[model samples]
Target chain A: MSAPIIGLVDYGAGNAASVRRLISKLGYRSRLVNKHEDFEFVTVLFVPGVGAFPSAMEALTKMNLVKPILDFANSGKPVVGVCLGMQLLADSSEEMGLTKGLGLIPGEVKALSSMEWHIGWNTLDCVGECSIASKSDGQNFYYNHSYEFQAPKEYIVGVVEAENPIVSIVRKHNIFGMQFHPEISQISGFKLMRRLLEEFTDA
Target chain B: MLKKRLTGAVTIRNGMVVQSFGYNRYLPIGKPKVVIENLDRWGIDEIFIQVIDRSAKSLEPDIELIDEIATSGILTPIMYAGGIQNEAQAAQVIRAGAERVCIDTLLHINPDEVEKIAKRLGGQAIVGSLPVGIDNNGIIYWYNYQTKEKRLLNDRLLSLVKDGLISEILLIDWQNEGFDEAFDFRILELFEKYNLPLILFGGLTSEKTLKKAFDAPMVVAAAIGNRLNYSEHAVQTLKNQLTSAPIRTAYYHDRSIFKHYD
Candidate 1:
C-alpha cells in the first residue's frame, strides 16, 4: 500500500517537527497543517500537544483551523491525538479553567485522581477487543501528563490500570485519541503506530 | 505501577558534548547528535541535555542542536537546561523539540517568572533545576553561580517545590558531579517530609551508588553524567547491573528501522 500523507497539526503548541520527523522515519510523508487549506491533500491527521489546555485551544482558534479539522474527522479519516492533544479531543477540560475542546470524542478531561503527576513509563491495560488491544496489550508506553481522558467504557480502548483506571487510549469509528506519546515511545510505540498506519491504509 | 527512570545527563559545551567536573572543568566528549543517538539507542529512560555554557555565556537555548536531534527521530524525552529565564525562552526551547526546560539561573535570579512560565506552558513542561551542596556542618545550601551565593533552600525554592510550580525537581550535586560515587544521598533526607519527586544527578555512576539512590521512594530518576559516555551500552549495562524488580529495565533496540531509514 502507498503511504498515507500524515497531516501533522502545527499550531505552535506541540513540537510538530519531531512528530513529522518520526513519520518520515516510519517511511511515511507528512505536511504541516497550519492553515485550513493545507488539509485538502492530507490523508490522516496527527494532533500532537504538550502544553496547557486553554492555550492550545486558543492557538487552534486563532489559526482558524478548528472547523476544517472537525470536517476532516467527520469525513471518517484516521485521526490520532497524543498526550494533551487527546485531552483536547474531549468536549471540555479543567486544566487552567473550564474550557471547551474539539469535541470529536465524547468525553471530558479531568485531573488524575491518583497522583498529581504521572511521568516516566507505564504499561497500558487493554480493555475490549480492538486494533490496539491485540497489538499493544501489556506493552509499555512513555506517558507524561497530569490530566487524563474521562470517557465511557465503550470508547475506552486502553487504560493505565491505576486505582481509578485512567483512560490511556480512546477510539470511536475512525478517530483515535492516545494519552501517551507514540512518536517518542521507541519500539513499543512504533508497533502501535504501525498498526495505526495499517488501519488507515485499509480504511 | 510507574517504573523508575534512568536519564543520560549530557553536559554540552558549545554544540559539542563534554564531560563536566565540579561545574568548572570540562573535557570535550564528541558531537551532541552522536551522544544523544547512542543514548536513545541504549534505551535510556530520559535524556537531560545540560548546556553548561549557555547561561554563563549569555547565549540562548541551543535550538539548532535540539532540532537536529529531534529530526533524527529520537524516541527519548529531552530535558534541556541552560539559558531559560522567561516564558518566551521556555516556550522556544519546548517548540524546538525538548519535552521540558530546566531553568538554573532564572530560579535564583527571579523565581516569580517561573510561576508564569509554568502557567503558560503547563507545570509538566517546567523542571526546576537546583544545584545544591551540603557543607561539613550538614547545612544544605543552593549554589547560586550568578552571584556566588550559597543561599539556604528556604529562599523561595522550598516554597516553589511545595507549591508544585514545576513537574519535577532536578537535584544536581554541582560540587561532586562527574565524580563517581560521590553523590550524597543525605540531601534527600532533608526533602523526605516534602514528598517531592526528585531526579538525583551528579556523581551517580557505580551500581552500588545507583542502588542506594533507587532505594529512596522520592527519587524518581537517576541522572548519570560523564561516566555513562565512557563505555558502550553503558545505560543498558548499568541498568542490568542494578536490576531489581521495581526498577525499569526494558529498553527497545530499533536499529534495523533506523538503519533502514538511512
Candidate 2:
C-alpha cells in the first residue's frame, strides 16, 4: 500500500517542475532524478522536456541517464516522455541534424518545416487503439514544440490533427510518449495524466 | 505539416484573476486557483499569468497562489509574470514552481536583467511580454502602463533580440484589447525579418481571426480570453473551428493519455 514512486528524469530542460507538480497534485509521490540509481523503487518513469532533441539527448548523456531511461523503457515499467522528452524517444531527429534518439519507437523526430512552432491549445486527434488516449474524442490538449514524430500508424495511438498533423500519442508495450505536454495543458492534461497513473497502478 | 500553439492567459491583480480591456481596464475575475482549475479542465496547452501591478516597487510573486497552483494537480506549465526586475526574483519565481517568467516594463528598464535571468534559466524560460499599441499614424509603440508613456516597438524588440534577452515574445495589442477586431498582421510585418517566436494576444474574438493569425510563420500563437468565458461550448467550438494544426503537435507524441507528475 506504499505510495507509488514516479521517477521524473530531469535532463536539464524546462517542463520537469510542472510535471512534478502535476504528479504531486494527483496525490502521488514523484521525484526528479538525474541518475539511474534513483529508479530502484520507481514505479513509473516520466521524462519531461522543453528544448531541442540533440540538446536533450546530450544532457541525458552528460547526466548519464540515457541507459537508465533505455533500461526503464525496456523493463516495461511504464515510461512516458513529454514534448522534447517524447522527441528524444524516437530513433533520430532532422532538427539541427540527423541526431540519434533513445530509439524506443521506430520513428524519427522531424522539424515542422511547413509550419512554425505549432504552439497552442489544439485537439488531440485520437486515431489508433490506446487504452487512455484513444478515448480523448477530439479533446484539445496543450502543445509547445516545433518537431513532429514520424512514428508509423501501428505504433501511434493518436494524432493531434491541428494546423499540421503529428503523432500525439505513441505506445509500445508499457512505454508511452506524448508530443503535447499534458502536465501543462490544464485539466485535460491532468485528467489524462491521472488516467495513466491509474493504469500504471492497475497494470 | 503545420503546427499550432495554445496560450491561456490569466491576469493577476493581487494574486487573483482580473479582466482588463486590451491591456488596461482591470476587472476582478476571481481567484487564480479557480481560473487555473478551469483552464486545466479545458486541456489548455500553456497558462500565462501576468501580474498587472507588480513592478520594481513590488517584489512579491503572490507566492501563496503560485504555490497553490503548483500543488493543485494543475499539471499545465504556468508562466508567471510580474514585479520581476532582477535575476533573484526570476529565479525565485521559477524555483517556486513557475515553468517560465514573462517579462515586460522592467525588462526594458534594465535590459541586462533579461540577459541575466535568461542565462540562468535558459532563453526559452524567458519571454518578452510586450504590451504594444499603435497610434492613428500606424506606428507601433511599447506602452508603459505605469507611466502612461509610449515608445517605438521596433526599437525595443530589436534591443531585446540583439542583446539575447528573450527566446520568445508575447505581443499584446493594446488597441485590440476587447474589440475582437482580429489580430493585426501589419503589426507583425515589422518583426518578420527578426523571426523570433511571437505569440499574439488581445482582440482574438473569433476563430476566424485565429485562422488568419496562424497564416504567418512568425506568429506562433494567439491567446483567447473573454470570448471563451462567454461562450457555451468554447472548448469544442474553438477546437472544431481552429482547423490549423499548431506547432506543438509536430513534436508531441502521445498527447492523449493523462499523466501523473507529482
Candidate 3:
C-alpha cells in the first residue's frame, strides 16, 4: 500500500515542470526522467509533451530515452502520454514529413483535416470502461493540437467531436494516450489523473 | 459540434490585476491568482492574461506572476500576452504554464521573429493580437498602445496569416476596450475572409452583446475582462443566461465533485 513513484519523462519537448506540479498538487511524488536509467525505480511513467512530432522524437533519441519508454510500456506497468507525448506513442507522424515515433501503440499520427485546430475545452465522449474515461466521463477537458491519433477502432476508448470525431483518449492494455492536456483541463482533468494513479495503476 | 468559447480575461498592470478601460485608466482588482482561481472554479473555457505595461517598458514577461498562477493549480488553459519579443520569451511563458502566447506589438514590428517563435513552438501556440480601430473613412488600422500610432492593416500583415506565422487571431477593438459598448461589427468584416479562428474582445459587457459576437460565423471566442471582476461567478451567470448560444455550459454547477486544493 505504498504511494506510487511517478516518473515524468522529460524529453525536452514538453512542459514537464507543469506536469510535475500537477502530480505534486495531487499529493504524489514525481521525478523528471531525462535518461533511460531514471525509469528504474518508478512504478508509473507519464510522458508529457508539446510542440512538433519530429523534434519530440529527436529529443527522446538524443536523450537515449526511446528504448527505455518502449521497455517500460511493454513491462505491463502503466504508461500515460499527454498531448504531443500521446502523438509520439504512434508508429509515425506526418507533422514534419513522416517522422518515426516510439511505436508503442499500433497507430499513426496525422494532421487534422479540419480548417480550424481543436483548441479549447471539449467534452470527453467516453465509449468504453477505461479507468481514465470512467472518472472523466462526459467531462470537459482542454485541448490544443493540430494532429490526432488514427488507431484501430478497438483501441480507441474516448473521443471528442470537433468538426469531426478525433481520438482524444486511447488505451491498449497498459499503454494510454490522452490527446488533451489533463494537467491544464481544470478539476475534471485532475480527477482523471487521480483515477489513473489510484485505480488504473493498481489494476 | 464545436462549441464557442467564453473566456475570462485578467488584465495585469504593475504586478497587480487591473480593470483596464481602453488601455488608459486602470483600477486595481487585487491579486491575479485569486481572480484566476475563481475563473477556474466557475468553469470558464479558457483564461487570457495580458500584462499591459510590460511591452512598452521592454521588460520580461512577469514570470513570477505566471509561476504564481501556474502553482495556484488553476486548471483552465492559460493564454499569456505582453512582453513576448522572441522565441525564448514565448517558450518561457509556455513553460510557466501558459498553453498559448499572444503577440501584439511584436507581430507588427518584427514578424520574422514571430515566424521563428512559431517554428519553435507550433503555430497553434502563437496568436496574432491586432489591437484595431476604424477611422471615419472606414479603414481598419493597427492601434499602437505606447506610441499612439496607427498603421494600416495591409497585405504585409495579412501575409503573416498566409505564411502560418500565427494560428489564431485576437482582434481587440481599441476604441471600446474598457467601456460597455457593442463590439465593432465592422472589424469582424475585415478579417472574415481569412477564415482564421478569431477571439473578439472589447466592450462585450452584456449577455446580449456577447450573443451577438458569438453569432458571428468567424468569432470562435468572446473574451470579457472588467465585467467579470465586479460579480461573483460572473462566468457561470453569463453561461447560464446564454444557454441557447454555442457556448459550453459551466461544469461547476454541481460543486460537490470539485476539490478545492489549497
Candidate 4:
C-alpha cells in the first residue's frame, strides 16, 4: 500500500511550510502544490494560510488554482482549510472589502470586527460530529488572527473566543476548516491533524 | 486581571536534544519529540528549542528534529535557536515548524541577517539570544560563541536593538548554571532602557523567583531548564498554580470552548 499524499496549497502565504512540516510530522508525505498541475496526484487537499484573507484569496486565484482546488474539494476527497485558509472557504470576506472565496462553506470572513487577534493558546469548544474534531473539546489550540469565519451555525463544528465570540472550526461533510494553527498548537493540534489523516485515508 | 503564559525550553545539541547548562556541561536527553510532548502535556504556552549544538562550528539549524517535534502532536509553540546564521536557515526553521528563531552568534557576525529574518518572518519570530558572563571583576560581558569574542553586554544589546534586528531578547547567565542562584536582575536592568521583551534564563530556581521576575515590567517570561528538569511534577505543579489564580477564571471558561471544536 502506498502512503496517502496530502496536498498543501502554497499561495505564497507564510504558513505553507509549517503546514507541510505538520503533515510530514503525521507520518505522511505532503507536497507543496503552488502550481495547478500538482492537483492530479493529491489524495487530499489542504489550503493553509496565516496572513490577510483578501491577499491570500487573490494570490490563490491569481495562481489559477481556485477552480482545480474547488474541483478537488467537490470530488469528495477530504479537503481542509486552516486559519486564513478556513476563512478563504467562505462565500465572501469583509476582510478588506467584499472579496470572494471558494464558497465551499456557507459563511463569510469578516474582521474579528469585535475581537482582537485572539493570539496565544486557547481551548476548542467542539460541538458537532467531525472525524477530526470529535470528542476533543477543552483542548487548547493556538490562534493568531484578526479575522474569523461568520460561518452558519449548521457548519460550525467548533469555536474559540477572545473579547468576542468567533468560530474556531467548521465542516460540511468532506470539507473541513479550522481557524487555529493545529501545527503550532502542540498535541491537540497533532491529534486533530491525525484524525483528519485517518478519516480521509481510512487507514 | 491579566493571566501570564507558561514557557518551556528544549536544548538541542548536534541535531539531538541534549540537556546542558553552565557552559559546556552536557547531558543526553534522548529525543526532542518526547521532551516536547512531555512539556506540551503539562500545558506550556510557548516552547524554546535552543540548538546549542549548532553553535559549536558551522551555523546550520537542525531542520529534521524541528520537523519531528512539529509532528509529535505537542500543543505548544516552539522557538528554535542555535546555528541560525542567515535568512535562509531562519526561514527553513520556520518552514520546519519553528514558530520563532533565536539568533546569538549571528547578531554579532551579520547583524543584517537578524533584521532580514525578522523582516521576512515577522519580528515576533526573531529573537536575540545573549549569553551574559560575569567576569572575575563582576563586569558582565556578552559572549559571541561563533566568533569566540566577549564584549560589554549593554553595548552589544544596544547595537542589536538599534539595528532593529531584535524584538525580543533572551538573557542567559552563563556562569550561574546549576548554581541555584537567581537571574542577574541587575544586569537585566540595563535592558529596561530598551523597548524589548526580555526573557530571563540561567538561574531560575523556584516559583518565588518566577513571581519576582513576573513582577518586573521588563521581563515578559522566564526560562527554567535546570529547575524544571530537576523537580518532579514541577511543570504540572507550576501550571496548576498559575491556572488556579482568580485571573484565569475567564481563561478557564475559554478552555470550555474546545468542546465546540471537538
Candidate 5:
C-alpha cells in the first residue's frame, strides 16, 4: 500500500502551518486544503483548529468547506480534527450563544464545567481500544481551550478528568478528534501523531 | 489532571534575541529562530516570545518572526507577546501560528478592546501581562516602562481579571527580573484575590522562588528566560532539579525528528 496523502484544511484560522510542519518532521508531505480541488489527491484530512467556534464555523462556511469536509469524511478516508477542529465535527457548540457545527461525529461543544479555561498539559486516560491506546494511555498532551467536546460513548477514545471527564480524543469510523494539540505536545505529541498516522497509512 | 508548565521564554530586541536585566540592561543572545529551536528541542512545555521594544517604538507585532517560528516545525506550544495593542493584531498573531497572544499594553490602556478580543478569540487565547514591582515602602504597583508610570493595580487592569478577559495573568517582576532572590513576594499579594492562574516571570530563576511560587495553588507556570538559556538541555536540566514539582518529565532532544523534514 502507498503512503497516505495528507491535506490540512485551512479555514482562515487554526494552526495549519504548525501541523504541516509536524507532518514534515514525521517524514510525510502535506498540502493546504483550500479549494474543493485541493481535496482531490489527498487521502487523509487534518482540521488544525484554534480560536472561537462561531468564527471557525463562519470561516468554513465562507470558504464553502463544510460540505467538502462532510463528504470527505463520508467517503471513509481518515479525517482528523484537533482542538477547535475536533469541536467543529460536533453538531453544535454553546461557545457564543449556540453556534451550529458540521455535525459529522454527533456531539456538542460546551463550556467546561470544572474550569473556565483548561490550559497547561494534562494526561489522557484511554477509553477502551482505539488508535495509540496501548501506547498513548496516560500520556500528557498540551491543552488550551475553554470548551469540551461532548460526544457519544462509543466515539470517546480518551478522556482527562477535571470535575468532569473531558473528552480528549474521539473516533467514529474513519473520523477522529483531539481536544488537545498533538502538533505541539512535544515528544508525546510526536509519538501520538506518528503512531496513529502510521496506523492510518497501514490500514 | 493538568500538570503545571515550565515555559521557555525568548526575549527579543531589535529583531534579535537578547537576555534582559530588569527590563532595561540587555545582553545580546542570538537570532530569535535559534533560541526558539533550542527551546522546542529541550522539551519546554510552552514557549512564549516577547519583543520588548515593539510597543515602545510604536511598532506592530513581529509577524515575520512568528511565521518563521511557526514554519520552523516547532513541536512545543508557542505564544507571542509584544506590540499587540488591539484585537486585529492579536488575531493576526494567532493566525501566524501562535496558539496564544499575551497582551501587556492593551490590558492597561483599553480594557474594553480586551473584552472584544476575548469575544472574538475566546478567553483562553489571551494572556494579560503586567510588569510589576514593589516600592521601597513595601507597596506593590504595576510599572509601565513607556511612561515610567508605577501605579497601584488600577481599575482597568483589575477589570480584565474580574471580567475574565484573559485566561491567566503573566505577572512579571520587572525590577528583580534578572537578579536572583530579588522578586518580591508582595507583588503576588495584589493579584491573589482575583482567583486566576498566574504565570510568574522575571528574576524567578532560582529553585527556591520557582518552588515557592509553584506551591501556591493558583500559580500555574513560571516562565524562565535567562537561566534556561545558559546551557544545553537547560529546560530538562532545570526541571530535573525541581524533582518534586508537578512539571512533566523533560523529553530528550532527539535530532532524528527533524532529519526527515519534508
Candidate 6:
C-alpha cells in the first residue's frame, strides 16, 4: 500500500517546518494546509503548533480554518494535535486569560503549577491501549510547554509527572492530542508518529 | 518522571565547528552539520548550538546555518544560543526550527528584553545563559567575556525567574569552561537558592563530574561540548554509563525507520 498524504495545518503558529521535515523522514508526503480546501483529499490532518495560545486561535480564526477544523474532527478523520496545537484542542485555556479552544476534546488547558517550566525530555505513562501511547509506553519524548491538558481520565491515554500528574496524550476516538513534540522526540517519537499514521491509513 | 537530559553542544566560530576552552581559545573541528547529524543519530536528548563569534563580531544569529541545520532533517530537539539580542532574532531562530533560544549577554545588558522575549516566544522557549565565574573565596559573579566585567550574582536573576523571563537556566562555569577540571560544586550550591531547573556545563569531561552535577536536585540537564568532538557516539556512550541517572537511553535500532534514511 502507498503512504497516506498527511495534511499539516499551518495557522501562523511556529513548529510546522520541523514537523514537516519529520513526516518526510518517515517516507510520507505532507503538505501545509493553510486553507480549508487544502484538506480535501488528505487522509490525516496534523495540527502542529508552538507559541502563544491566544495568537494560535486568532490565526486559525483569521484564516477561516476554525470551521473547517471542527468539521474535519466531526467527520471522523484522524486529527492529531501537537504541543500548543494539542492545547488548542481543549474547551478553553488560562494562558493570556481564558482563550477559547477548538473544543474537540473534552478538556481545559491550564498552566502548570510548578515553578519550573516542563521543558525537557520526559517519559509518558501509558494509561490506555491507544496505538500511539501503547507504542510510546514508558518512552521519553521531548516536551517544551508551560500549560497542560486537564481532561477526564477516560479521554487521557498517556501522562507524565511534572510537579503533578499532567495529561501528556489524550485520545477521544479518532481525535488525538499529544502534549509533547513527537517530531523531535528522536527514534521513539518517529515510531509513535509512524504508528499513528499507520492507524489512520489502515482504518 | 521528567528525565534528566544529556545535551550535546556544538560550538561554531565563524561558521566552522570549534572546540572552545575557557570561551577564549578555540580549536577548529569539522562542519557543524556533520556533528549535529551524528548527535541526532546517536539519540541525544537535546542539541545546543552556539555560534561563539557572532557576538564578538557584532553579527546576527547565523540564519543560513540555522536553516541548514533545520533542513538537514535532524530529529533531536535543538536549543540555539549566541547573538540573539532581540525578540525578532529569537522568533526568527524558532521559525528556523530551534526549540529554545539561550541569551547570555542580554541577561546582564537588558533583562527587560529577555522578559519581552519570554512573552513573545513563551517562557519555555527562552533560556537564560549565565556564564559564571568563582573567586578563591567562593563568591559567584556573572562573567562577561566581551567586556571582561564581573557582576555579583544576586536577586536580579531571581526577579527574572519571578517574572517568568526564563524557564531554564544554562549555568556555565566561565573559569573552567572547555577544560578537564571538575565542575565547581560551589556554583551549584549558590544557585540552589533559586530552585530553577538548571542545565550545568563547563569542565564536565567525565561521567564522575556529570554524575556530581546531576546529583544536585536542581540540575535537570548536563551539557558537554569540547570532549564530544573527539569521539563518535560520545553521547550514546555517556548515556549508557549513566543509565541509573534520569537520562534517557538510546532507543534507536537497526529496524528503526531512521536507518532507511541513513
True contacts kept of 4: 0.26
Model 4: lDDT of residue B31:
68
Q: How accurate is candidate 1 locally (lDDT)?
A: 0.84
The alpha-carbon RMSD over the true interface for every model, in angstroms, is 1.3, 5.4, 1.7, 5.6, 1.7, 1.5
What tens-digit string does per-residue lDDT give for candidate 6 at B1-262? 7788888989998889988888888889999999998888888888999998888888888878888988988888999988988989988999888998999878878888888888778888888888987777878888887899888876777788767778888999877888895578889998787788889999888888988888888898999987777787777788878877877775546634566854
TM-score of chain B of each: 0.95, 0.86, 0.95, 0.84, 0.95, 0.95
Which has the greatest DockQ?
Answer: 1
- Model 4: per-residue lDDT, tens digit, A31-144? 888787899888889988755566777788889999999888888887889877888889998865899999999998876656333555666887777767976787777776
The list of candidate 3 runs beyond 4 A from truth reads B253-262
Using Cα atoms, each model's DockQ against the true complex is: 0.73, 0.25, 0.63, 0.19, 0.70, 0.70
Report the candidate with higher TM-score, 2 versus 5: 5
Global CA lDDT computed for model 5: 0.85
* lDDT winner between candidates 2 and 6: 6
**Candidate structures ordered by DockQ, highest first:** 1, 6, 5, 3, 2, 4
Candidate 4 chain B — worst ten consecutive residues by lDDT sum?
B244-253
Query: Which regions of candidate 6 fall more than 4 Å away from where they truly are?
Result: A1-3, B250-252
Error of 5 at B162 (Å): 3.2
Q: B1-262, model 3: which lDDT tens digit per residue?
A: 5678998899998888998878889989988889998888888888999998899899988888888888877777889998998889899999888889999888768888988898888888988888998888998889878789998877777777776667778999978988986578888887677777789999988889888888988788999998888788888888998998987786555554445444
Residue B233 local lDDT, model 1:
88
- Over the stretch B1-262, how does candidate 5's per-residue lDDT look in tens digits? 8889998889999988888889889999999999999998888989989998899999999999999988888878888889988889988998888999888887667888888888788788889898988778987788877888988887767677666678898989998887876777877776677777899988787888888888888899998898877799898888888988888876675677557444
Estimate, for each residue in A91-161, the C-alpha lDDT of model 2 and write its tens digit.
Answer: 99987678999999889888665554455566777777777886675766766666788888788888766
> Which portions of model 5 miss their true places by more than 4 Å?
A1-3, B260-262
Model 5 Cα displacement at B197 (Å)? Answer: 1.2
Question: Residue A155 CA error for candidate 4 (Å)?
Answer: 6.8
lDDT of 2: 0.73
**Alpha carbon lDDT at B90, candidate 4:** 84
Per-residue CA lDDT of model 1 for A1-203, tens digit only, reads 55578898888875677677777777788888998789988898988898788899998999897898899999888888888888989999987789999999899888899988898888888887887556799888888888988988899998886777779899888888888888778888877887887678568
lDDT of 3 at B86: 87
Off by over 4 Å in 2: A1-3, A11-13, A24-27, A94-100, A152-154, A162-164, B1-9, B15-30, B35-47, B58-64, B75-77, B85-100, B106-127, B146-149, B155-169, B175-262
- For model 1 the TM-score comes to 0.96
Which docking category, incorrect, acceptable, medium or high, applies to candidate 4?
Answer: incorrect
